[model samples]
Target: MLRVCSVFLLAISPLLSLPTGMQNVEGEVSAPILNEDGSLLIKSGHKSSADWESFSIAPGEHVIFEQASVNSSFLNRVIGNEGSELLGRLSSNGSIFLINPNGILIGPSAEI
Candidate 1:
C-alpha cells in the first residue's frame, strides 16, 4: 500500500540529473505495470535509452506498485524532488531505492 500525504510538496531541483541509462520522457509518466505473478515493471521506451521515465504524483493520491513474485534482489527505484513527503507501507522481498538530491520524508507508517 502506497499513500502520499495530502499536503505533500514536490520541490524541483535544478542540479539533479536523471540516472544513467534513463531518460526524461515528455508529458506525464504513469505508474509502473504490476504483473499477475507479483512482479512490477516500469515501462521504458527502449532498452538503451529512457529505461525509466520520470513522473509526478499529485497530493493525496495513492500509487501502488505490486509484484506477484520476487525473483530478483532489486525491485524498484523512486526518484522525487526535494521536500517531498512519501507515506506508505511497502512490503516486498526485493529492494527499493529512493533518490532525492535535496531530501525526502518517510512517514512512520512506511514499511520496507
Candidate 2:
C-alpha cells in the first residue's frame, strides 16, 4: 500500500541521502536529524557556522535551529544552481543568516 511504501522510505531515507535540504560545505555543524514529527533539527557548535549547497523548506515541514548561544549565529550560503523555496516553519533559537545569490522565496505560510 501507499502508506507502507511511505513508511519504508522514511525509515531508510537517512541512508539514501541527506534528510533535510541542507548540505554543509564548511564549518563543523552536525548532520540534520529527522524528528518523529517529520521536522528537521540542526545543531551547531560554538563560534561555528556552515555553508549549504541547497537550502529549501517545503510545505508542512519545520526546520529548527539550535546554536551554541543566543548571540551565536550560523551563516548558511546556498551555492547550488536553483533558488530556495521556504514554504514551511523555520524556528531558530539563535541567529540564522541565509545567503542565496540565486533567490530566496518565503511563502505566505512560512514562519521564521
Candidate 3:
C-alpha cells in the first residue's frame, strides 16, 4: 500500500488588481522614477546587505522589476508601504521577497 500527503497554505487579505501594459526600466535603487501612467520600473541587479531604508511605493501604483536576462537564481527583496501593488516576471528559479504590511498582489505573468 502507498499513501501520499498534501499540504496547502493560504494567505487571507484583500484583493488587489494589477495595471495594464506595465514596462520594465533599469536604473539605480535610489533614483526610482514614476512614469506618467503611474507605473514604477525596477532594474534587474543584485544588492548585498541592502536594507529598505528609502524603498516605498504609493497607493494605486504598479511596480515592475526588469532583468537583463533571466537568471534562475536571481533574488530581490523590497519593503513596500501600505496600499501599493507589485508586479514582476521572474525566471523559473528566481525568487522575490517583499515585506508589505498592508497587502500585495502577484500578477498572472509571474512564474514563481
| Top candidate (TM-score) | 2
lDDT of 1 by residue, 26-111 (tens): 32233455556433334322111122333223233333433333432222233443343454334433333445454556666544
Model 2 C-alpha RMSD vs. true structure (Å) is 6.2
Ten consecutive residues with minimal summed lDDT in candidate 1? 44-53
Candidate 2 per-residue lDDT over residues 1-112, each given as its tens digit: 9999999979854432222356665556888888898888898865555666677887677888887789777888777776778877888878888888989888898888
TM-scores across all candidates? 0.36, 0.75, 0.36
When 1 and 3 are scored with lDDT, the better candidate is 3
Between 1 and 2, whose TM-score is larger?
2
Rate residue 22 of model 3 by lDDT: 24
lDDT of 3 by residue, 4-28 (tens): 2222211212233332222222333
**Model 2, CA-based lDDT:** 0.75
What is the Å distance of residue 24 in model 2 from its true position? 4.2
lDDT of every model, 2 decimals: 0.36, 0.75, 0.38
